[model samples]
Target: MIRTLQSGQQCQVRIASVTGESTLLYSTHRILLEAPNWTLDGRSLILNGDGKLWRLDITSGTLIEIPLGGIPDLNNDHVLAPDGESIFLSANDGHIYRAPLTGGHAQRITPDDGSFHFLHGVSPDGAELAYVGIGGGDFRQPGRLMTIASDGGAPARVNVGEGHCDGPEYSPDGKWLYLNTESFSTEPGHAQLARIRVDGTGFEQLLESKTVDWFPHLSPDGQYASYIRFPSGTQGHPADLPVAVVLVSTGDWKTPLHTWPLFGGQGTLNVNSWSPDSEHFAYVAYPPATQTED
Candidate 1:
């Protein structure tokens, strides 16, 4: 349920529920991990830890290191292809990459000159990837919602004029991509839940509020969306804050059915973590900020 972090505190990773209860899946020894994806088979989970990818066998309690040949540092920005044969990830250099799900050398997808690249979603057909990139602009470097071919090519900006767009996950049919875009507040980036088409058309706001919202993940059955919410006026999704994972019906996108508390903020739910059946989701919560010396 909980493991000691480098900070000498218990770090928790939970398989969260929409309504009733949530249970702990796995934990590590002073090694905090980010992002949790139940494999297509539903027997194991894939997560990034200690700057490399790890496959945690749920039934056997074994951990196998997934070999990413070239990238020495992996971030929270990673996703499994829909077919579960490929992986798309962002390395420390802020460039996108693609590697086989079985694990091997990674081939670069984005230019090496960029400052930040976060791989949020892979389309159903595995032909396109929606991600966030900071660059392509002058000083101050704003983030953009962009999609690129899985074979590696230039990224096309998805929203025409939307500002600070992040977390782009595709609809089950691949027609719409859900994401979050920020508005101006007393702080710099205050996010909202939204969606757009793959062709960069049909840009519409799904949920608008004064509170900061991010990571809009659509269910596989096309009925609901799960996302995380931070307190109003929070500049960004920072760590160790009082946060909640709120579920909303896709049609209304306003009223929430459940609100679950957490001790994490940034790496809690950065990627699409819904189960194959689309009934449950996954999220990570940290130890308190006060603990540090494991």
Candidate 2:
């Protein structure tokens, strides 16, 4: 469970347990939590706050700050390697770094050639990494999805075209790469969830939504795909609210197995990581605020 607090005119995040029957998991104050990614063992959480990486131990309720070496300016969306040994994080300097999970120096994996690269997912075997590379000098321009070996090699483009692609994740079997494609438009801005073969063929659309839908994560069991869905009519503003987490069946994308409300809306409430058992997922939820008259 997550909670939100009112900080003057803004909101902050607070982490709690999902079980409603337990009062021990509740928090009396809200903290600035964002972009929570789970360790492979589900015993810890990795999140970005204060422009730095933090590891939280669930059992001990301790928060340990991890230094990002020389690379700073990493937003949320940092993923832990499948072995839980290393962390892949994207820096504001247009590069990706691999660092030890226990807090040490981070080695620059991707080149800082002024092209933006965002780290999204690591293969279950920890051999490959899926990322989105934006063209031009800035990341806001058009981009495509690409995958490269963890040891560093030639990156292969999995999706190519004029459409903007973001949030790439690999299936549990490591056969398919899931992502969201957004065409530059103001009319509804259709964003669809898609999957492509690792070999860069057989691209297929799994789901479509009028509002923005991204951050696709395949459950550990390979049964469901969980994503964040922003409701229609709210776009390109801080007033936008994440409505729910839509869980779609892997075999059939037409139907949703479950939909849960995010409750809080101001802060980042996107789904970033899943438990190893695939039963429960972790997300950051901020407290909702009273609506003001326009």
Candidate 3:
């Protein structure tokens, strides 16, 4: 059974597995739903819609709203903590929060700093949080990759070149944090995939190309990494575009084991969504709505 809201999204939401099977899990007609994070048990998916969060049961295809009382301005930037006990969310106000996985009052982790913080991933041991921080309302400016204590404290900037750094994910072992950086806001096409240490050192470039690459998620088994690539000259990964999800061998796995074309870019797979077994991952696709004769 495919569920849809009558007013919000321009298209429908789909759960596409790596085995090439895609299903219409949910949709909204009034509010746009974006960004999905998989559960550690692989039984459900948690996503944000209308400034609130929802849990979608993978087996029953049911949608349940998580009661986020205090955090009314939640964004798509969220990830399940490694402990599988709590969830961290980046609200629209640019502050980070920790809440119960089942949903409740969220505790703000970052202070009321002027800079905006959008969370990318939580450390393996769930102690550090890596995110991109920058001045608010100016999306064109390059962002800095930084980390903070998961509980709440001053943030330390990761040692990366001055550029637009985003989509920071930690390796399973908590040694390397993978991220993408592009020099100058003028040349957005130069985005390259790279990884650095949690202490802000030992940085190395992983992949570089003319095409813009964003959101690289390593598999749970520590064998492969998957990410999304955008077309030439696109900035900030605009929505409703042709994109491909590429899978690469992490530790001598291989290069480009699989890449699938889809119709979503920015909010498709912003968080670590690999399943527990490491066989297939989950991603959302926004397909175009049927043309109505206007």
Candidate 4:
């Protein structure tokens, strides 16, 4: 979907410590930034705004746009490849594309199938991509968890039951794909955290709660995880709502290591934002700009 920064909304990019501290890295009312991926070198972050990609240097606090010769506007779903030099992007055109991290022409990966590919994860070895496929580009159809060869070929479906699913990411170890699914509940829009083996076995829910949870991003070390939590009964991670970025130990997701409350959702923590060192992760907030007195 095309996302525009609504009037009076300011985008704030903040880095949070796993231990419970958050630092504002950058804030701007000019553009709407979403879904940050920390660079391998830990020097900068890659985010998409204004239908284009941008690089934010954490230390220097500088923002630069990364131009793509091909491919349409991008969605929040983008994953950095394991090689650290390549990236996989989900464009508004309903196909996936691969491009250089530094910016260049994009190579389309998914075929011109009837389905729309929304990318979320690349394998640890960068051999495959896990994404959600909406058949016939139909939003009414449940998103099916799918995987395809990184270079592009016939996509394979990983049955996630009858319910809709999103954010199928590979574990750091590459053994499992983590995501959120609504199969566990019959209620509409009630997505919960879960994971299944890459081979489509061992499906299990990570935790249960009345609150709707979407993306489950694991740290590089595989010891911790971070996910977005919405209010109970909220339908499909929407914008401009009260949400929380919850951090927890992978060993026990039932307990939260830290919870950072904010007035943001959707683009806030959509992708895996954990820093390479696992000490920090990035997220965005879009709290409306308070009016100034005349």
Instruction: Score residue 235 of candidate 3 by CA lDDT.
Output: 75
TM-score on alpha carbons, each prediction: 0.89, 0.83, 0.89, 0.98
lDDT of each: 0.76, 0.66, 0.78, 0.93
Report lDDT (Cα) of residue 200, candidate 2: 80
- How many residue pairs clash in each candidate at the backbone level? 1, 2, 9, 0
Residue 250 displacement (Å), model 1: 1.6
Off by over 4 Å in 1: 1-6, 113-115, 136-139, 160-162, 183-187, 289-294
lDDT of 3 by residue, 1-294 (tens): 112433333544565555655567665555566777889988988888777888888888788888876764787789899988789999888888999998789998987677889999898889999998986647667788889999999988886888788889899898889887775335845677888887777877787666788888998878888888888687776677888878788854236777778777867878887877887777776666642111
TM-score of 2: 0.83
Local distance difference test, candidate 4 = 0.93
lDDT of 3: 0.78
lDDT-wise, the better of 2 and 4 is: 4
Model 3's number of clashes is: 9
RMSD vs true structure, all candidates: 3.7, 4.8, 4.1, 2.1
Best by lDDT: 4
Query: Per-residue lDDT tens digits of candidate 2, residues 40-157?
Result: 8778878776667888776776777887577776665578887878888887676778889887888888754456777888888998888888765464576678787887777777
If both were scored by TM-score, which would come out higher, candidate 1 or candidate 2? 1
Candidate order by TM-score, decreasing, is: 4, 1, 3, 2
Candidate 4 lDDT by residue in tens digits, 1-294: 667777887889999998899889998889889999999999999999888999999998899999897989999999999999989999999999999998899999999889999999999999999999999998999999999999989999999899999999999999999999999999999999999999999999999999999999999999999999999999888998889999999999999999988888979999999999999999998887673211
